[model samples]
Target: MTVFGCRICDTALTVPVSRVALPVHANQKYGNGPGSLAPALEPGTFAVNPLPSGSPWRRWAELEAGEAEALGWYAPRFSISAGPVGQVLLAPGDVHGAVIDPALVGDSACCGLDGGEPNMVCVTCGAPVAIRIDDCGLRQATWLDPLTTHVLEDGPGPHPVLDWADLIDQRPGIPPSEPGGGWHPMWAAAAASALAHLLAASGGDPISIPNHQVAKVFRPTLDRLLDPGSTGPERTLVLAGPDIPDTGGHFALIPEHPQTGELWPVAPPVKPIPLAWDAWRYLAFHRTPKPVGRSVPIPPEALPALLPGHRFEPDGQIFLSVLARLPEVRQPRLRAIYDRGRPYSYTYCSF
Candidate 1:
């Protein structure tokens, strides 16, 4: 296990946290009531139409499963699965050996604290140490920013390497889905956070999201933020990693090491789009339910579809907070991209 501490004061901020097997995706909610159903669909089987509500086909639908399977959904996206995975928790207090800054605590709509920013500072030096993102509905805990904190190797012996395949293979029973709540709030929050990282990774270049399904969720904000007039080479976002065969791509959204938080690089070295380890793992291994028109029924021997349009609006505050922490956001060209997209707004919604 590794102990994380404040960089400035070297104050031991957290205990040696290890990866624990979880019955569901860390971000997904498995409520005890009748409404919360686990997402049950294969990855890349669905496509989303990100157009406005006025558009005729704004809902999500299954891709031609045979073709999608053959082509492998040549876009960078995540799957929603009803399976078991691993997660880590870093709570505040003596039990976890964490010392959070009382002054740095920020209020959250759902929970009392929002750690998307450098909200947790070092008690000794007052320098930002980590982000504590335990809000209501979210798996409450703190995430130590690798840039601001140092992880020290300690404990009895070397920690066991967390095997991605093992975690993926484990299966847990599906959870109940909420009747009215179609979109998972935590999923939206995590996706919004990932979108911020993707933009910063773009380096002011036009990013091409091949799969319209995933693109629909992000394109609204991206189209507004990216420079249309720029002649820079276009970069395509592809999902490539150990499970998915890398058929040569410019950029990738790869998985992260569960225990260490180190990103697993895509083969051949393409620009990487960062995502939370659980998010990436779920996307890589599980199938997400596709949104369909209300009357449509599940197709036989093919991907399932559902009614109502699913919309994902990147939280403005979360986007800005994450963007500010990234060094790439400082580049003049990247800054121009943000500036050109005046009046930032994410309005993709599902009924």
Candidate 2:
């Protein structure tokens, strides 16, 4: 358990939180209706250094020659988040003894807060301590400023971290469906990292994915990116994990450790493509529509749900950012894709 408090008064600002190795795409923004927006981190969880945004933006030219390179940035962006350390991200509703500063709000035209610096202040001392971001196009989170906040306490207590077996059994799936009848935005964001590693492992060669609803989400992007005619090796991605539903290929797509964010282990010469645990569960224990007897004279085997017809789309910004961080981007064929900004001339539009 951990409780972060305001440095000035030592008053607890946050509820007891546990460490969470959040996804790489945690910061990737998704467009959501004003009324339906959800916080980035789950309640009772907190992630550190989850790419803090705002105020401390730095231009590519402003960075020292080796600084950007050291940051594993092979390409350039308009600006980079040169934000502060000790950024403990939390759900907005989780913070106690704190309130939003109406005067420091961001993107006034929108229904939610966006990029106001130190928008959150200590309720007791009025000390500027954190940033509250909940804009429509950004991930909603409360970012604790290290200078104004200190960890009052953190220690293991009752709820321990789940091991791989327990996590697999839970089947807390990321359903491809969403509120407005489209593919979930989280799936799209996750595709960025998953696709990056898959492409890198392809070695500028062809790779195939088995036919499955979840696999279909990735197949189009993978095919377009790894054009066999345009590009070394060949591989077929096999859904490999404990009790994963599909099976066969030597090339494995497995879940990283949910708690540690560590990629799963694979034997020599076999590259492990990391899949988010939530998405992995969707593929592993897919719930097919089964027949249920009807008293109202409806068809017995009626479908449970109808998925949207639109193709699964990857978030372009996140996809590019993910690729640039991989060593395989140095490969000319793959590098060209990164340099071009997006994989396709026209991106998949769920909306």
Candidate 3:
């Protein structure tokens, strides 16, 4: 664990926090009109997205000849972000010794940080050091601007290193339902991202997710999108994890560590598709009927959950965002499907 301090005054700005991989949904907007979101990261941990963030974007044509490959994007995008990198993340509540900049709080109807500009300043030096977002339709977090702060590298902090065994015992399961009567936003985002990986693993071949509950969430899209290829056995995706039993299958959808974003290791060398730990825990450990994201009020009244009503659709933007980063996306067969992703709005949807 390490503390973050002001570059000028050297005043400590946060509790000692450990590093973790940036989540796919850190910048995802959950609902339309107005809504609140849970914090993006746990209090004592932080994540850094190596990919660029924000705008002053550059299109493919604008990049210098070899710059596209260097930037890690192989496919064409409307525009690529050219913003600052190495911004440190923290839960909004973890921030201390900072004041919200009244001048910077956005004037949008959401009435909080719209993530347009820095909204918090370092108290010691009055430097714009953090962008604290608690606005509607956005993840709640505080991003310590990379250029304005520095880390205090000293002795290890008091936080303990939790292993897989400890996490399995300590972490609670994630219910698919949200308090506001929809799917858990994180669940929706993670599932969408994972769905993209499953598509890539399909290798342009047809695949089946064996679990009916899992099938309901993914199969509709799978059946509709993937062109059937010459096949002997269609690839199968089985749900497997900490204590979940997986019969022999072509692929396994396993839990990823929530803190470190590390994919769980499985044997027999079956390719892995990572699901969020909490969501996978609920699926693997609790084998009851699953709840649908739509039309069900939470505070359920029984044992077996009601059969899901609506076909689950992964967030389109999230699907494209995850898939666009894959090396396979360079293949024209795969690239065509990627082009059909509806999130971009500009892309014409075949379905």
Candidate 4:
């Protein structure tokens, strides 16, 4: 079993209680529509870059071969259509080897858990150790703060690769048959987080994003927050993923290493504008609108696919969770952006 420990106190923080196959990405949401079902690909048969060579999907081919090789693309071991599967598990009590620091807790409307800050700390050293996220719509988990913990394996094991097939297959299962099924809180939080990153990437200038589904979801919030009078060359927000092309000068939403949580850049030479990997994966592959009243026409190239059935609600808890984690979001001007919209409310349409 792999062991994760606090760097400062050398205390064992967590150990895998068990290992199970889960959707390769954490933030993916599957759809209820039959056409939206995730495509199943055989192991080792998928392409490292899934987009067609002539596909207008962005310049992922521009990535150096060395960089692509370094990513070690592979297929996911489990399928989401089957059930709730995961590769690792740590029991609740074993999640943190210490008491959580109250000061690090950030506000969350979903489940009242601190999704923004490091809620767990090393008991012996009093150092922040993990983020306890038990939010209402999200799968409860304690993400070890990579900055504070060191993960060690028993031996020199093969490093895991980024599996394109796994990403395509592992979206959230069907929603509960309750009144108004669960809205993906993480999606809103991720969109809000991406918006903050986009602003930072703009270097204090106005920017335009492509008219993709992600853009549709966030434009309202972005328009409400950005200043109309700002002056600078217009920058575009591009989707960067394993298959999408390199982001030439555009602001990129790149994938993350599933195991280590490190982001992979489209252009390896430039600094990345980080978006959660699962968020980028969702934006890149699942572009169709959620199944609702009207049958939204799908682009000829962007065919219908299985995606999560949750209603698209801008979650305040997720927005705050994302906002608090970013340093750029703390700036006085950027900090005020959240207030520009109608005060975030539990009911829909407030943000």
Candidate 5:
């Protein structure tokens, strides 16, 4: 067994709890500061994607470098003795895959530092760290919630780590076997594709749920659900359709096309919700579903009724237009949008 240790403070740790095998996050500077704290994981537990299952020295180096910079901490330039070390547990090598090793040390090894509190830190760097090993070998469809179990009302089933090749193998669920319903199958596929595309573009090795990839997948899904004839779920309509449904602060999609004067589903522009800036928002353009920019140039007839007594002036359009162009992936812009107010004009279809 090889033990990992931090040279800075002469602190030594064993496998499953040592610097070598343990998950680590820096706590240096974030948005102008000296990071968060040393071994931020000491007081917390966090997941690490694409664990060091194989000899991914280069990948590990890159990850450590980037995370270190973000947290304003650096890896020590030293190696501790591997002997007298605790078990060296390897997490699943792939994010899209799974590891079904039951004895690989469950959550016991990654126990919280502050008397079981999830939040922890390294005494040396004060960065957050969580030493966990995922079962990447056991691939299966999963719910949108990453932490969810297989048998649930979540996203997909047996969602084994699917790649482009894998997509072709399975006969994707066809669009609602019957038309006139919300984004049933096709929407789900587009959403999935979009998510895959975004993840690839964002330099994400393996897509993480609720990440930019997921957001991309959400776009097409929203469009499908927005189709007026779509019967995806009246309940989901509150989150996807134009006019706010009675769902109350839930996500909705536009049912019809606001542009091109067609019934095609429109990809609603992602928006932040008020009061809950961290969440997404969806709104109606006219009586029809209008997802932010996805439904620009509201029909003259629908605009009046949709605005409902509001001055149908260019000012309102301009304000909404400006808001639509905000960046979704950018952290700062996203934060600002959330600071605004949540309204029927915004969409909240995805988690």
Candidate 6:
């Protein structure tokens, strides 16, 4: 079989051919999708100008590397600590470019790659360097598993090209109104890149992710809201839509319970407007790629019934899903809120 690949890099000694032609197409390629690849690609012949100082892109790269390295130190609480039998820990979110699976649920050794190997070359740049693949025997390490959503231990650093997954039940958590660490777009982008890198590294394996690992990356807004020192207006609730444009809607996130007067806390004790699947799917898919930190529209009629003294503005266009009862919403005809700001972008709505 003619297993083609770019020759600017080297090949595995165990492979059929020890030396392949230069810049030939490879056996696989992982597009910008779930379960991608993270092979050590050879650097190219040419050198490009460096990025400007303190650019967001530069910071993002550092955050990505930091998050990946952080996985190396994470310990799996689910694994039997009696002693190390044979084990291997995988981080699929690091490998896959998308968040196909989040949270750790169980343990296994093999994971299925969504699109298999990546063979495509980066047209923007070229490679010219020596490369070789060796059977790096597994070392005892810890990482997050995308499929099982757990943290587990396995053989040493830099495992061989093996598809691994842990056998564990999936425990899906309620999707958060604000994904990533915080509501800011920059923070979301950085966190998403790191999380995506972690998933991609796992090769979509089923593994256990420890609670500490989740807490390390997850910044619960609830914590901030409860902090008595926080000044200014706090954020308490969020309303979002799905990736689908026409299906978007909004809801208010409230604490488990409200205390004191109508002047409610804005940041901490927050969740999304209680919505069913129809409304949720729309918000989940249509909501912006990053949280915009905006609130749902409180109709003039409902305003009186809502928390008093708080001003409510129809922030963005509510893409009401046809499948559910239309939210009792009325937008100001003469003025538009969505027109003044960017709308949320979601994966489902891309099509």
Which has the greatest lDDT? Answer: 3
Better of 3 and 4 by TM-score: 3
Query: Which digits, one per residue and each the tens of the lDDT, describe model 4 over residues 94-139?
Result: 5657676778776653334534556778988899876655444344
Better of 1 and 3 by TM-score: 3
Count backbone overlaps in model 5.
78
Q: Is candidate 1 or candidate 4 better by TM-score?
A: 1
Per residue, candidate 3 scores C-alpha lDDT tens digits across 1-351 of 688887778878888787766887787776653655788788787877787766568987889876766777766777888787888889877779888888877786365666666788889899888888877778888888777788876434455656777877888667777655566777777787888888788777778776766776678878777775546468889987766655878889988887777888888669899987777777666555556675755443344552245566566677777777888888886788887664452221223
Residue 284 of model 1: what lDDT? 54
lDDT score of residue 216 within candidate 5:
36
Per-residue CA lDDT of model 2 for 103-214, tens digit only, reads: 7676563767765578888989999889887776677788898879999998652246888788876647677778778777677777777888788777776776664554
Q: Estimate each model's TM-score.
A: 0.51, 0.86, 0.86, 0.49, 0.19, 0.18
Q: Write the per-residue lDDT of candidate 6 for residues 213-313, one digit (tens) a residue.
A: 12222223113212345353433223322222222212131111100101112332222332222222222332223325648764433422211122211
Q: In candidate 1, what residue range of length 10 has the lowest lDDT sum?
A: 46-55
Q: Please give, for residues 1-351, the per-residue lDDT of candidate 5 as tens digits.
A: 222333333233222211111221111111111221122222111122222122112332445434433322222212211112122222212112222223333353222211111122235553322222212211111101112111112222122333322322342222221243322222222233223223223221221232222233343423322234533333211233222334332222222211111221234342212110001111221133455765457554443221113111111111222233233323342233323312321222221
lDDT comparing candidate 3 with the true structure: 0.74
The residue-level lDDT of candidate 6 at 240 comes to: 29
Model 3 Cα displacement at 69 (Å)? Answer: 2.6
Candidate 1 contains a number of clashing pairs equal to 16
How big is the positional error of residue 308 in model 1, measured in Å on the Cα after superposition? 7.8
